[model samples]
Target: MSQTNNRDGSNKRSRILSSDVYRQRENQSSTNVAQTQSGLIIDNETALSSEIIKEQLNSVDDIITQAIIEVPTKHLLYVKELGDNLFVSLSTKII
Candidate 1:
């Protein structure tokens, strides 16, 4: 906000360190994705492969079903029967 004079008697405006506006400059080559020889850019090679993605998703259902089946019976506080299916409520109490 103030001006300071240099030893040469030239007036120079001093920076007041304004934080109202911030800027970030990133270098392009520092990114996580690497450019292939064919000019194709890949980030985590297995992440984009369909076979790997399908394999990862395929196990999700089994993992979720296993987690549900492994829950302790004591945690089931409420149960409602609907035809051949069951709607169960699990307790979230810390104790």
Candidate 2:
């Protein structure tokens, strides 16, 4: 099966294949094969850029220092509690 969409002012087609068909076709075409093998097609450059963004977001020491430097001491408690809850929720996964 295939689906078409317009992205960035250009038309693109996404092809979907079942697992057995995918394995049979894997070595025949390299253009989109790796992506299908991994279950989804994501541009490599976009993935690398987002990884950099994620590293910055998870920098806890910088976040804490900035909060203490800019926010009132009384508000620090609220920030801490929110951070703790956010951490717990992010680390837990639904099955």
Tell me how candidate 1 scores on lDDT.
0.46
Candidate topping lDDT: 2
Model 2 clash tally, residue pairs: 0
Per residue, candidate 1 scores C-alpha lDDT tens digits across 1-95 of: 13333532332222322221111112344366666547777774434678878889888765575334455354453332332244243454435
Query: What local lDDT score does residue 67 receive in model 1, on the 0 to 100 scale?
Result: 34
CA lDDT, candidate 1, residue 34? 61
The per-residue C-alpha lDDT of model 2 at residue 54 equals: 93
Candidate that would win on TM-score: 1
The worst-scoring run of ten residues by lDDT in candidate 1 lies at 16-25
The TM-score of predicted model 2 comes to 0.19
lDDT of 2 at 51: 73
RMSD of 1: 14.2
